[model samples]
Target: MFPTLDIQQPRPFDLVGSTILIAGNAAGFEGTLSITVSEGHDEVTGIASVGSLGLRQFQASIYIPDATAFQLTRIFVTIADDTGNENGPSVVIPVLFGPRILAGYSGWQPYTVRAGDTLTGIAQSQYGNADFQPIADANQNTLANPDLIFPGQILRIPRNDI
Candidate 1:
C-alpha cells in the first residue's frame, strides 16, 4: 500500500526559519521518507527514518539555501515515499520563505502593526533603510498588500545581519 503523510506544524503560509521543524504523522511505509522543499526554481531534499507499523509521528529538519529563501513568496514542503517515483504518495505543505533566516541570523523578530504604519516606514525604522521588500516577502502570508497592513496584525521581521 502507498504511504500516507500529513504535515502538522508550520501550517500553510507560515514563515519558516533556516532550519525548519517539520512534524507530522505517517503510515503505510517503513525505513525512510523523503522531505523536499522547493520554490519551483530550486529544491532541497532530505531523508527521515520512519518505522511504519501503523500511524506514527515523525519530525525532520530540512535546510534551505539562502538564495532560495524569499526568491519566491511560497515554497512547497513535501514528504513522500522514497521509492524515487514522481507519482508516489506525498503531502505538500505550502509556506512563505523568509530571507532573514540566513546562516547567521536564523530567527525573526515579531512586529505588531499599528495605525498609520507602512512597509517602507517599518523597514526604515527596523532596517534603517526604505527597502521594504524583505519585510513584504517575509510577511506575504499575512500582508497581501505591501501598503495595506492593519492594526493588531503581527508581522515577522527577519533578523537579517547578512
Candidate 2:
C-alpha cells in the first residue's frame, strides 16, 4: 500500500494584490503536520497542526499577503507519523512581480518580444528590450508564437534586477 497526500491552490493569483488560501489532505496515519512557504532563501511563513487525524482527513488555511506581496518560490507540506516518521511533498509556485510602470514614464512601458509574442516587435518599441523570452516563459501556454498576441493580453514583464 502507498501513503497518499494531496495539496492544491487556486491558480492565476494576483501579484501584490491578492489573498491565497492554502488547503490539503492526508491519509494512512498522522500525528502532526507542518506547512511552509519560501522564496529562494527567504522563509515566508509556517504552521503546525496540533490536533490528531488518524486515518481521517485534515484541512487548514494560511492567509497569504496580510500587508505586502505574497512572493513565493516554493511551498512545502510535511506529515509526521506518531512513530516520529515524516513524509510528504513540496510544490513550486511561480512568482510574477507586478504591472507597475518602471519609473518616470508617462506612456505605457516598453516590453521585449518573448518566445510567443508575435507582436514582439511592437512590445519592443514599448519596452525597449528584445529579450521578450521571459514574457513567453511567464505566459507560456497563452502565448503561442512571438507574433500572435491577441487583444487585451496581459504580459508580465520580468524585473530588471531580481
Which one is best on TM-score?
A: 1
Whole-model lDDT for model 1 versus the true structure? 0.76
TM-score of each predicted structure versus truth: 0.83, 0.41
Quote the positional error of residue 30 for candidate 1 in Å: 2.5
lDDT of each: 0.76, 0.42
Instruction: Enumerate clash totals for all models, in the order shown.
Output: 0, 13
RMSD of each: 2.9, 8.2
Give lDDT tens digits, candidate 1, residues 1-162: 634777687688777776778887776355578888887777888998777676778887888766444456578888886766788788888986665333355567899999999999998998888988877877776777897888998888877656
Off-target runs (Cα >4 Å) in candidate 2 are: 10-18, 27-31, 48-51, 55-57, 64-162
The number of the candidate with the highest lDDT is 1
